[model samples]
Target: MWMKAVLVALLAFALGYLYHTNPMLQNQTLHLITQSIPQSLFSSQHEPNSANLEETISRAWDALITAPTRQWGRIAVGVNACIDVVVSGVNLLQALALDPGYGHDHDVLHSKEDLKETFIHYMERGAAAERFFSDKEVFQRIARAAAEFPGSQVYVGGNAALMGQKLASYPELEVLLCGPVGPKLHELLDDHIVVPPQSLQETDEFHLILEYKAGERWASSQAPQANRFILSHDVSNGEMSTLETFLDSLDEFQPRLVVLSGLHMMEGMGRALWENRIKEFAVAIADVRNEAPIHLELASMTDREYMSIITKEQVLPMVNSIGLNEQELLFLSQAGGGPHSDLHSWSGIPDVGRVSDILLWILEQHGQADPDSEAHLTRIHFHTLAYHVLVTVDGHWRNQRSTVAAGARVASSQACGLQAVDVSKVELKAPLSFYSSFTEPKESLVLDPSNPVTVWQRRNVSFHLSPVLICKQPLRTVGLGDAISAEGLVYSEIVSQLHLD
Candidate 1:
């Protein structure tokens, strides 16, 4: 009896030892597996492999069955092992959901690093797929794949904020700009722009033209001639007659590019109408089979809250009516899905840059026939969008400015291997009523700095000149030159558009 008891105790000790060392015997769940096996599996030192995974796990299971203390350790070991299997399965499922094409890339299990990279690629694929789907579709797909990726949350508001910001910032690049009410926008001064209203009747050759409402500020700024452009302000504040007049003008002008600039200024003063203007315009254009492209540039009013509601509840719906595909539509967003950058306060920089490129592309396409025609000359348009924003509310402004400068300086240092950025080129467009631009208007968008997809493409045109002098409000007048010459860091938001494969 003594010999049998000793033998049983020895067996139990051996089994317990095996279970402790073996990963297979351990639980699959992160928490339970931690309890069942030693912490070495997760350690960076020990590389994970399929065979090792199997072998270690099997030993853990064997411990529960063969050990003398099997009864005591069995429950915990079994639970841990089960948890591990589930967790691994979950990881696999999540990856597969992200990319249906996964597993075809490789057959045999390799190093942990390889597995991690593959997993990340799949996750990215899944995210891209999700962007193409609607809310309902996303919800359905996510529900099916829920067990695969743990701790994932879906935004209920959808991509409204993302899309709105994109559209605001990027206007059509190939736009036939025609306007006089606003200042000769610095961005489009060189391209086929028609200034002042009188020149509109003279030129009927161009397909599209942007026009603005007439005002005292505009009349003083009128150019020599105006191309046959669409009228932006035929309406009397809220009068329906404005649409009638606009349609009539469109028929007469027969322009291909249309733009409505500074429309939000009217909205702020309670003179603006046509809440769903984009949708209505789409319907009207479709009825007439108008091949011209239309664009509306609106600045937000004082209350951002109201702007949000309008964009989500009204503007987005209108944009959809204009027939944008999934990818193209998303490009209009401020977020990744669209055009808005998290950097600025829904203030557009990137989107406008994109639009400038697109407009240049369109014009270039048209200009190919008569390459040297003055009509194809670069025209830059600058629209000033001013909102009632408290740029420096309270004392938080000073610290925020410092933080911004510090971040820029750091970025410059890393990118150029220099302590400070040199402002080699500083270009400024003529300042209009609300804003100004300084970019060269006639350039094409360059898709890539290196290995660009299109030879004809140039980066989006910047509205502001390079090497901007940023300073605090209090120091604006007195310390402006000192800051630029002494302390300020000059940088550029170099725009680069990607070509779809």
Candidate 2:
């Protein structure tokens, strides 16, 4: 101890003169010295390890199963409903029965040939993307081709539709779903879900979902992660036909929470029409804003112009909370005129430091932190393949650990397409070890098995990150994000006694 103290004193004396003359050089020297220190020296906290991973999975499930559920909480979900025609691991050329010519640049899908090219474009890069097909028959053709695959199935698809069903599963919660429910969707939805008296005469909108697993090969294209790309042609949703009907029922139903989505459906409907629809949505959201917490679940919007309008005019002032995936998160930053607005999209797991920075920016710049902020955005639940991060204002949100754990748990179960996640069929896909922030890599956020939910504070908000138990064989990738968001909201409404860690 005496020798170490002497050495420290000698080093400080040697660098003290340099520190006063050139602070940058002295700081750099200190950084080098600290960086040389081994990570094991900081193991007193918790290091992310295999044992910790297994324990976290166990604890997350325990938290979900025992979390207190909100009862009699009236929740309104609306603005889109669709039948998803799902096809997994499809061969783009064989499905279309046409050669895309591979090297051509077809940014927009117009004809059938353009559709094949766009799919190939994203597939080769292992990216998840959505393309709007203006022609209704173009989507129908893809649906028909999907039917040729043996195990292809049809499921409820849409932000409003899928989330309403998941929330209604609690039995105690009163879930009012506002959308056109054709005969097929009505049959799939639970009886607990209240379908408002709306236009039942409308034809069912269809979304073709093509799913690809990591390492899934189609010709020269291979996927980097398990994900799905959506293609939509909606006659009803594109027009905002149900907005008035939904807003009319808001007074009588008197929801505690209002969830808005599917505005992205208006992307390809031209500027004037789409802008007008977003303005109407903004009004609808504002009407319910005072009565309840409004959560916006974001989806794919290929049009940057539309993204800008929604972020600035609509989402900035009305929505209180939000749920989005990695791609949507980056795109929101890019489109919303945030700090990283230049960033368009990202593939695979995004960097934690970057994601954290964006979340902080949204909360500070436009969230409820300020007295004049209209949207009063209090909470953000961001989920991806590897992990789930929940950001919330100090006094506005509670039980964050359980809320985030529920999100991570549901992500695994729903992706596996199982009512209950099988422990044996899952693996720890998260990074064994990760830093709290890339800017401060010395502060390692090692996963502690005893404490599954990693908690931290920065400025006015609290951040919670929970690692996910990824399913080894994903039976269903579609609707997983919706399931995660729904589950997170369910637990967020009420504090749990069994789980707070």
Candidate 3:
């Protein structure tokens, strides 16, 4: 009787407090009441069917800047930031007992149901997408509910912020972050990452990622690939406010590498608003020194005009390097009128043949593929669940063997959330022997477990293919892409830099 009375008293107080105070964080408060989930909720690990790439992975780890460069390099990554809450996607859906309907289309989340339905709509196809939400109360209820999961976590999230943090991990690198880092975010960022004074905003919004593993099933849909579905509920990042002060300070830093991302946040904000912000981004990008290289990290975009504007008139052509996953690659190809213009959604793993065609088109048309081309694009890094490829204009990049391996290693380690990859939780899914290009299979290159990084060239462009050790139980998937791109960029030696011999 006493325990029941205590429970009643606690429930009454919680109701009264929520009725009067903040409802956005109600999930954070209620998680303490429910029993935490047990380890059994996660799936069992898998051992490799064939010999795993342990020896190759170790060599890559050992080569992790084995000789830390004596010369320091400065890098800048920015233009958006938000709080992130990550939870086991399948488990959370089960907890809700929600059979989210497929094909729900809405640019902005109208209510809690809209959020769920839209999430499943994309999840069914294993596409990476982000939808903006203005219904604060509805989003709050849903976000807080997801956070109630026992293992749910929060971090400073967004392409710019997360990539900046990843870059700070490298030695002899000065990392400057351009994104919102108010008092609350300041504590979450790495102490080494420099947050300028102008990039300040109140932390009212949080991005929720329902992360799942490969082959994880949800109702009738089975995820063909390991990926994330993001929901953005931030007015600050959606407006591209972080870049406001970034332009004024660009010359002060004079970074060797300038990274621009999160422009997709402006999508769904009415064309007038996003169009103007794109101009601002172009201005900020054009300010880089002629010698330094700039990279644009692509995101999932739904608006066709937004994507068309990217390749047709604006930002993509200004940067020399870019990083994107399969889904984003397909979307860009369609919008740019490349090979796969008919694809509106994907049902399974993206075909390697189609991916090569698009990457080649981007290089030949928009990138620096032509000998006398004034266009700046020279590098493209494409990542997938089973593999990663780094393509660059020949003679513009070096250290392919080690740089490509480093990218593959981070993809495994980051997604599994392991300090170092624990082979017990992983298996090699990448083919031991495969065709290097889309051309008629003349012959396939065999992968030796001991020496796994594959290098082949196509005319003037160079290709480095590194297979990933698939993680059976992915602990986190939100920032794995950013981490992979950062690793590849750090280990790379770009041209136009004077190196001490």
Candidate 4:
């Protein structure tokens, strides 16, 4: 017994010494702890109850519709040349009392004919048209108006302008609408072509979103609570000229930042078109990088399957930053070969450490895969219902500046949340009640300079984890992604840049 005890003590001491001395072992230990955090610290019980969700949604809706549009109007006035792409059609929605059949959770079914049939059935069942606006027109008008204040240019292309006539709200901001416009759109826009529209066979189709509530229901005949379904037709053609037009605008305008969205285009057009578009855009952005420092950001990526392709082909090559929600992050991580891909749901909030670890792993994998890639991502932002996590490539932003930017982003997102429910005149400040139960004060993690685990050692990465203002019940979830992305970018990029200037 005495001999065994001595052997055990020596073994333990040796292992401890090795762990302390070896950076790789230390990182592995840290990885294990972080990997366990989600299951241990965050559990399903933390999810908001159905009643709370309903109430929150109701209140948010009431506040949103009644809120004044001028609040956003002010935001629109501050930005410069916000360009978006592809199909920006109206969203037709219906809140279903029925269950979401089987195998449909956050799953988008893409069938125009099937969606049309569903739309007709829902209309017959008393569903209503929630709101209608052309994404191209709305985004263009707002961005153009905002850019006018800065005396900049806003160029909107893709299928967004394919069906609509060019309308410039502000002369100072040239709203150049490019894309194939059919005879129907030609007639509607009264042939007011700012740039001659490319001839395409069809216009973009409207998106239909069906939302469902919660119940313990399953694949069985038992009905689901309420759920949402979205349907949008694909209009992502990989033609070189289409991309050339967009690149031409980039070359001419030479804007500081460019925002790319419309991931849904992949569903209809297949991965081929998606890949071509990304590669083309990435090459174009790289070629023009020497002329001006252009920042590229991608948003509204609902589909996870294409994330790996986008990350490797587009993001690593040229894109500077990428923003995604928790679920999207989970999917991307899983698809991109991260260990924690098996999470059942994102309802339970993850802590800062766990979130950071996952993001670092992703960055490490991507960086190692293509060390020769021209552009290295400067930031990876993951926004959840409860909090926001930002991982900046070393030296991107100072700690204090990042914290302030994060707080400002939180405030802006909260306002957009209220606006999502149709609340008019969003207050500049976030209400105290908006803070989530899982949220604490913003936490910062400065990577150790001497012992870094990430593959890229050129700079120390900084992570800022900020809690979000909670809305117990949210009336609408449709535009929340867009709102969050738009507001956060405006605050971090536009507002902060302006303040600095």
Best by lDDT: 2
The all-Cα superposition gives candidate 1 an RMSD in Å to the true structure of 30.3
Q: Lowest summed-lDDT stretch of 10 residues in model 4? A: 73-82
Q: Which lDDT tens digits does candidate 4 get at residues 129-161?
A: 221122444333433333333222222323234
Better of 1 and 3 by TM-score: 3
> Ten residues in a row with the worst lDDT in model 1?
74-83
Best by TM-score: 2
- Model 3 spans > 4 angstroms off: 1-72, 90-97, 103-108, 289-291, 344-347, 439-443, 498-501
Estimate TM-scores for all models: 0.24, 0.84, 0.83, 0.51
RMSD of 3: 16.5
Evaluate model 3: give its TM-score: 0.83
Answer with 1 or 4, whichever has the higher lDDT.
4
Error of 2 at 475 (Å): 0.6
Compare candidates 2 and 4 on lDDT and give the better one: 2
**lDDT agreement of model 2 with the native:** 0.73
Summarize candidate 2's per-residue lDDT along 1-501 as a digit string, tens digits: 465556567656866776678643544465454345433322323444423345446654574444544442788899788888888635644667775347333434677777666776666655666667877676677767776677788888888999998998887789988887788888788899888867454467778888888788766666676777777777688786888888888889988778888777778678888877788778767867767778898886666677878778856556778998887788778766765566555645666667887887888776876656655788899988888999997877677888888888888777787777667767665654455554433244545544667887776778898888888888888888888999988888522222112
List of clashing residue pairs for candidate 3? none
Provide the lDDT at 101 for model 3.
Answer: 55
TM-score of candidate 2 on Cα atoms, chains taken together: 0.84
For candidate 1, the TM-score is 0.24
**Against the unseen true structure, what C-alpha lDDT does each candidate score?**
0.25, 0.73, 0.72, 0.39
